[model samples]
Target: MKQLKILVIDDEKLIRWSLEKHLSAKGYQAIGAESGEEGIKIFEQNHPEIVLVDNKLPGIQGLEVIKKIKSLDEEAVIVFMTAYGSIETAVEAMKSGATEYINKPFAFEEVEVILDNIKNKLKIIKEIQVLKRQQKDIVTFDHIIGESVQFKQIVHLARKIARTKTTTILLLGESGTGKDMFAHAIHNDSTRHDKPFITINCSSLPETLLESELFGHEKGAFTDAKQMKKGLFELAEGGTVFLDEIGEINAATQIKLLGVLENRVVRRIGGTQSIPVDIRIIAATNRDLKRAIDDKSFREDLYYRLKVFQIILPPLRERRDDIPLIANHFITHYNSQFQKNVSHLNEGVRAMFLEYNWPGNIRELRNVIERAVILETMTSLQPDNLPNEMIGKIEQADNSSKENYTQGNIGTSGSIVEFNIPNEGFSLYEIEKQLIIHALKKSDNNQTRTSKMLGISRDTLRYKMKKYKL
Candidate 1:
């Protein structure tokens, strides 16, 4: 470590000499100056790490010298020394940027301790600055990769609304369309960035547990109620709470949630008093909430309240232009995460990715890339790296009009094979089995190509293969 240099400026010759001697004995490079002007000159020449100036000086006052030194180097540590009955001046010095103030006739031990404390504080401040710089430099937008106009517009809207204090946000989109990713991004960019972001899938939890999970429960609230526990709302205090699969919440839970939204308060189960809470809410659902209200499954007032800032994410097929960006993002992401050097996707792979209707949206794309990265041996991901469903859709152009196959088939898989005219109709399972075999043949038994040609998940295709004893 570099030796600390301390400059002492005082009109008293004895005081300056004594302080200089004491500091030097303690392993500090101490310099003494008779006047504030001389101190500044020495300070400019030596650029001392710390400055100690007396309140009374010949020309410039102690506080003025401190200001000039600070103007030159704001990080330079400074301490003001004052005689008795002039503590008011010392306080004014502190407000003027003095790191510390010391009274006259200061004890050598006290001075040493104060200097040590200043050094430690400066070290901590430096460390905090470095950490903040690193955090600021890191890229947080790695997950939501897209360049299409529709995708760009959605991202832009999310950013704008994130700055607002809107308590409720409704994210409407089909399953796997990256609604959760956008919700997280909004929370990260909002004022609650430093606070907790609690996410709960309404459909994943049972009704009884869902109520307790969202709004806490007092002791003895239910048969198995062991102790009091905070719920999602209280846990996410001063932050945001994300409700995924909002449509799946039943009417009872809906009523309770509505109370929280309207009153900004929640009562624990079996508790009489309601406690105020501060929480922003973001709700996501694939179902049409308005229609659900009409059906009496959801409350109309809650629906309108949650729609304060609405964001409707388009499906992957609707934003076809973003395929390459999304694919390349996945390639880069999985490469680092999986420790694979997989570089790019081949032309055939890219075509299949764009042509296939991603019913699962971005979620399906991520899974595809993850699988490809794990199974791929070559530097580039070829068409075979994808699932059978994706490949099947790419090659099913001629047979597109079949009722069994829609533009975006959820899990349907089929193929063309001339079969003998049968007297009885074939079972759904039989027809499905025939389609898989024909797709496999058309792709020359290449599972990747066959899976793409079949428009089914590779796992599904494999399961069917074993089922048919192929």
Candidate 2:
């Protein structure tokens, strides 16, 4: 936090001394100047938070000083002091950008009141600036860049439900598929846009703590419960409560949550009274809740209640057409963030992105782009800028398509593998699995050599092996 600095400019030494003394005692860093010209020089050097100027001064008037200060910094707060008590002069001072005008021979209490009001106004302006930044920083639906048919349908459905009075919404997706971002977009577009939007991860805390965090607790409810506290449900009021990792909550908590969803009310852990809450519950999870229900971990009734408005996000692999759009969006984002002029990805780099399976989804792509932008020196994103895993995938794709490639397999005027399209069709997965096996056998089951030969990262190779049960 910065110290509040006040510049007191008065031709009378006694007035300047008195104000400086009083302000300094009140924790303000106050400076004194004998003339308008001197005050302006001090202001230019120190940039005080508040300026106090006497109307009648040598060389320049207080109104002129306020205009000069305002010109230097438009947001400068200025106080005009005058014993002349001329309403016209006060109006002129205000027009010249003096924040407040004080008549001289006034009590210190009056001056204090004015100063307090000015401080409050400045605090409010600062808070509004922070709030505006936060609101703009939110990942709204507009920020979700997608163009594939699957991606478009999901976004379209989400937008429709966002404006509805839906009590419960369940967002299902793999990890890093923007489930939380969707929740934010829904709340921002809803009727409770101006209200608080609180979010909590269900799996972050233990069951006891999690329950207390959601519904709050009465005073002395636990060893650490010293004061009566409001939970996220009560705090949100008519806003929204986003429960991420909804599948991770235990069955007991699920029942309580279901009751809340079914009755629009929540009860504190130690309190018997059911408090009515008008908040929307937006639950998201990367886990397979349907499977959890079959395993008797998640409540079936709770699942249905939360599934009133369901949204299933398509993974990046399923929306290959949107990869370029998303990648370009990340390029633009990183360009601004890293202060680099990354205009676009090169043709080969774009091909690699399109061919590679983004198992980590958008978040993985974002991290890749961020790293590349920081490392890349040229304006365009080139092959060298991509992660090794993606580079390996590029190699794998090239090896599969190129002719006369004889790294391990020997064939004349033909590639390592050849395939004929059957009328019944071919399985791409089987083709990929066979390629991995061939590489492994050629390397004598050496993972590192196999990864290098196949042109994929070792980690990716291992993941593929597990995926194919090799």
Please name the candidate that would achieve the greatest lDDT relative to the true structure. Answer: 2
TM-score of 2: 0.73
Residue-level lDDT of model 1, residues 1-470, one tens digit each, is 46789999999999889999999998899999999999999999999989999989999999999998888888879989999779789889988899998888888887888899998997898889998996664334445787766778888888888887655899999998888888888888888888888899999988999999998899999988899988989999989999999999988898898899889999999899899988899999999988998899888988988998899999888776577678888889899988998988876576667667788898898899999998898999977778887777766852553444332242433324444435664555666677788778888888878876765545445656876877
| Candidate 2, 1-470: lDDT as tens digits | 36799999999988888888888888889999998899999999999999999999999888888989999999999999977558899898999999999998778788899999999999999999999999778778898888766788889999889998656899999988999899999999999888989999999999998999999999988899999888899999989999999999987888889889988888987888999999989999999988999999999999999999899988887776677788889999889988998989876677677668888999999999999999989999988877887778767766675432323232343466666646686556777798889889988999989876766555457667877999
- Candidate 1 RMSD to the real structure: 14.3
Q: For every model shown, what is its TM-score relative to the native structure?
A: 0.57, 0.73
> Model 2 residue 53 lDDT?
91
Question: Which 10 consecutive residues of model 1 have the lowest summed lDDT?
Answer: 406-415
lDDT of predicted model 2:
0.86
Q: Model 2 Cα displacement at 344 (Å)?
A: 1.4
